[model samples]
Target: MARPVPVNLALRDRRIDIFFAVVFSAFTVTSIISDLLPTVGVDFSQPSDNFFVQSNYWYAHDADPLFMNPPDWMRIITGLSAFVYMPFYIVLVYALLAARNWIQLPSVIYATMISSLTGIVVFGVEFFGEPEFRTQNAVKFLLFNLPYVLVPLVLLVRMRKPLPFTRRF
Candidate 1:
């Protein structure tokens, strides 16, 4: 007798996973393209000259030579690179986590999610901060390429099990 067909749930899940992988890859490709392009060097002016900050070492010192009281959001965005690598570090930790079980899949997914969130927050901060400090290209790099890194990890994990039709081919 023929074996019973796999449940639709598994099929649906697989399809969604594949879709995510493709989307992630597309984002990575586009981000690379945008990064390669030359900056237009267009200048945009900001409204305020000074910034307001709480009592912190960096805050105590002049954050920007031009803007005495740059907005809090601007300060964070200007320094976003400090946090951008955290997601990548998480991915490596998850790689170790993967060795314990199939936990890598979730870890990879979470890494992507975290990276996306980081990108969004950075973008918002930059937008609200100084007009000259805008860096959408940096945000694009993180959002697009970060997810693609997980796709290969997932594919390798899934290849262990063969489908029923594979024997006939």
Candidate 2:
């Protein structure tokens, strides 16, 4: 059996890679901070509340028929993201910035799981839930959620192939 070839991060365009890493890192950090604020007693229900939560609430209001209020399930999911996934994203940010070869597998796994689950739940609520809870604007809803789906997908594709290895004599 032949050994699988590995992808070389060094061979890729450094500037572009670094740019993406920086952008994703910022996104992850902002998300973590936004989610963390609520845990520290920041009220997110009001539009005048924390900027991150306020922005997110408006986005959800514009997209989801549920409006400014999230359902219990959604709240639970948000809690999970806040308490668990946010920290994981911090690690991901570091790994991405460093171009660590070991991150490829875990990144793919995390991206797939998070994106797929989010998609399923979001779309399910939009389509199958009570009429009042269905999304008013599918396009806006999808657009609002696109980053979560697309970023991970792009990462998965870029990191699908493993990094090359040099055999020790």
Candidate 3:
């Protein structure tokens, strides 16, 4: 077996990876605040009763009313984000910081899942949902949620090669 050569990846030059690390770290927190909270029984049905949702304009805006109504499928995805994806976001924060290559498969999976969930399921609910379920602020909703799709897609492409951290965009 041939030994793989170690690439000297300078963190100073890896600005984008650092951005990804910060974003994933932020996601780690949001997974808890946004997704995990809902899964753990903090009701989103009435933002008036939910402290975070009530206090935060992002949630209170009702941009994505799915949070307010949260059907079974939405609950499932929130549970998934809380239990599965939240952990990944934590690991991803560390992985991106350390430039670890092993995160490729898991990140790809995360990207695909997030893209499909937000890109298809979420947007579908927001755009095509019954009037009651649709967002009152479609632009704001899309602006806030777009990163969930765009960032993962960027990471998906970033991880396409071996030693992904060594590669620069």
Best by TM-score: 3
User: Whose lDDT is greatest here?
Assistant: 3
How are the candidates ranked when ordered by lDDT, highest leading?
3, 2, 1
Candidate 3 structure quality by residue, lDDT tens digits, 16-134: 88899889888888788788766766655554655676643357355777776577888799899889998888888888888778898998999999999889998998889777788
lDDT (Cα, tens digit) per residue for candidate 1, span 1-169 = 9988543233233453445445544544433332211122111222323221121212212232212233454344323322433333344333332322243445445445444544455444445545654434555434443444455344344433434112211
31-57 per-residue lDDT for model 2 (tens digits): 575545544445555576567777656
Candidate 3: the clashing residue pairs are none
Error of 3 at 63 (Å): 0.9
Query: TM-scores across all candidates?
Result: 0.30, 0.72, 0.89
lDDT on C-alpha atoms for all candidate structures: 0.36, 0.64, 0.80
Superposition error at 158 for model 3 (Å): 0.9
Q: Supply the global lDDT for candidate 3.
A: 0.80
Ranking by TM-score: 3, 2, 1
